[model samples]
Target: MSRLKLAICVLDDIQPLRRVGSMANDALVLLFMIAIVLVVMAVTLIGGFYLVKYLVERTFNS
Candidate 1:
């Protein structure tokens, strides 16, 4: 039937768009993971710096 052929063609045309949407979703997930890792690293570095400063001050002052 001509109508069935037309529907199949439309579905084929839209399949690439669906694939692109999934790819974008994957990229966003990866970006968020990288951001989280960077944030954690920054927090630990800052905390360690302050902790060392505290220990050094305590050792020399006392």
Candidate 2:
């Protein structure tokens, strides 16, 4: 009976750990999503900056 109780206690402790392991995966996924968004925003801003620069140069110099 005591061994059975001990087994149950061990299983209870492991249960949360197993759940945490599964949930921890979301952290990595969230980081990747944020990184992709940032890269896209950076590329968009860079392209816009060049477009503005070209327009200004063409309008003023030509």
Model 2 TM-score on a 0 to 1 scale: 0.69
Model 2 Cα RMSD, Å?
2.4
Instruction: Evaluate model 1: give its TM-score.
Output: 0.93
Residue lDDT tens for model 1, 12-40: 99999999999999999999999999999
In model 2, the Cα lDDT at residue 16 comes to 99
Clashing pairs in 1: none
In model 2, the clashing pairs are: none
The residue-by-residue lDDT of candidate 2 on 7-49, one tens digit each, is: 9999999999999888888888999999999999999999999
Poorly placed runs, candidate 2 (over 4 Å): 1-14
